[model samples]
Target: MPLTFEDLLARARALPRLGHRALLGIAGSPGAGKSTLAEQLVRTLNGEGEPWVAHVPMDGFHLADVELDRLGRRDRKGAPDTFDAAGYAALLRRLREERDEGGEVVYAPGFERVLEQPLAGAIAVPPTARLVVTEGNYLLLDTGAWSRVRAQLDEVWFCAPDEDERVRRLVARHEEFGKSHQEAVAWVLRSDERNARLVAATRERADLVVRDLVGWPDRHGRPRTGGEPGPVGTDTGC
Candidate 1:
């Protein structure tokens, strides 16, 4: 059975009393709505203005564009090798171990899509935060640097959406990001599809699988549950 959004939030709230920082991983293939869901979760959790959670996205650790071009990997920008996974792992460790010293703040990395570069110290994880929700593509990947990502998380959620809808969203995202329609399609078919396959293989490893949000109803106009919808392509081509 699929877990409701409120159920997931309750799970997150329970982790803080366990004496260590809770690392909730939100991972999925390109355009799988990982970021969107993470944002919604944080907003919902902090809507009362307590600010108990902070988001640490893996995309923030992506290597700068010049570095990718230098390494001749520009064509594979979203590949696992294109990110500073080790650095991300290290930060996670720090976030878990360091005790809150009142006003002390820890700076982390962030990625800039328009500039195609990684901005250093762009994210600040405050000492008081109890839940650190990190979202990215390779959190559950079983090999290389990605393998270590999951071990650091208290729980991991894999977000899956309908296949045709996912592809449509990806194409739209590509177009919004300045890719020509043809280029977008080619990228989806080539790069995004490859990553999607890799991400899908990790679903069985996830602690929870999330379904995309739905509205209205089908032909009958009955309210639909957002949890158990349909199988979607596991492509998070961010």
Candidate 2:
């Protein structure tokens, strides 16, 4: 029998049992369904009863366009250097070490899709949250400040779907987010592909490699604006 989404849910549900609070990291190349899987896990696991799971995306650490301009890295916005890796690592550390002493809330930054900027204190993790699901492209990366990220997570899972499907999803994602089809395709091949290759090299470092998640929506399904397209594909190439 194959491992279904229910099996994945069971794994996620058991995470908090390992400690006071557990952070689950989902890493993947562009359009590999990292965000979508994380979202579903949080939703289904919390649906059982009172919500104890939280979703905190690493996209919030993206450097604003202005900073990218100053740094002359605007061309490679999705590259690892275009983000505040150190800041993200620190936030993960805080999330792991800090407990709700007396109804304390740990706020996290969020990414504004339309504006393509990071919004501070956009997400609130209340005292009730025991599991935090964070998805990003570089969680397993061992370079620079990114090296600190994996240490903060209880376990990290890498999403590896088919290459062609991943590229198609990346194209569609850019189009839905305001880019012209041609521009989206060009960006995917030029920029996103480069970043994707870097992320793929880090796959072996993950605790689990999720190939295909059974029952996930197909790519042709109604698309999400700021998140990954539905999981569609058979080949497991990250």
Candidate 3:
């Protein structure tokens, strides 16, 4: 049976009850709705409340563009090595261990789509926060330092959407982040697709596979993935 949003929400609600602060990783290709799922879960879980859930995306660990240029990897900006893998793993470990014990706030960096930079201390995981939802491409990858990431996450969910919708969301994300339509298309084809393939390979390693996130308009303003979800508005590009 197809998974529903309520099913996902119920799963999230159970995380905080698991003894300690829990970290949930959402993994997928560039446009597989990882961010959307993580964001919605965090948002909905904390609705009209004291905020027990927190969100921290792995995109925040992206090495700065200047650093990428220095290492001559600017073209492959979204590649695994293009980020600080070890640092990200370390942060996850710290987040899992740190609690409201001292009543201190935990700050995480955030990525700016427009400026294409990692902003430090952008997100604060409050002391009362018991669930941390993080989304990224390489969460399930077992290669190199990326393997350390999974150990920190209590569970990782992989997002897999229809092929065409994935591409459209990816392209639209690029355009929204400052690229021209032509440039966005080119990047999606040349770079994002490769990362997508790598991420797809890691899907089998995730604890769950999520497939029904919705609301993105199709090219002709028609629904893309059958009629499961009708046209609403734009997607929250992850």
User: Judged by TM-score, which candidate is best?
Assistant: 2
In candidate 3, what are the lDDT values of residues 99-130, reduced to their tens digit? Answer: 66675688999999889999999999887889
Question: Which candidate has the highest lDDT of all?
Answer: 2
lDDT of 1 by residue, 83-158 (tens): 9888888888888776665446878888776676788899898877889899988898988777778888888888
Check candidate 1 and list the clashing pairs.
29-235, 29-236, 30-235, 30-236, 30-237, 31-236, 31-237
Better of 1 and 2 by TM-score: 2
TM-score, candidate 1, is: 0.87
**Segments of candidate 2 deviating more than 4 angstroms:** 100-103, 217-238
Clashes of 1: 7
Q: Give the per-residue Cα lDDT of candidate 1 at 224.
A: 53
TM-score per candidate: 0.87, 0.90, 0.88
> Model 2 over residues 1-238: C-alpha lDDT tens digits?
4555666778788888534889999999998888888887887778799999999999999999999999999999999999999999999988887664554789999999888899999999987789999999999999999999999999988888768778888898899999999999999989999999999999888877787444554333343442334333323222
In model 3, the runs with Cα more than 4 Å from the true position are 212-238
Count clashing residue pairs in model 2: 0
Native-referenced Cα lDDT, model 3? 0.82
For candidate 3, the per-residue lDDT at 139 reads 97
Runs off by more than 4 Å, candidate 1: 101-103, 215-238
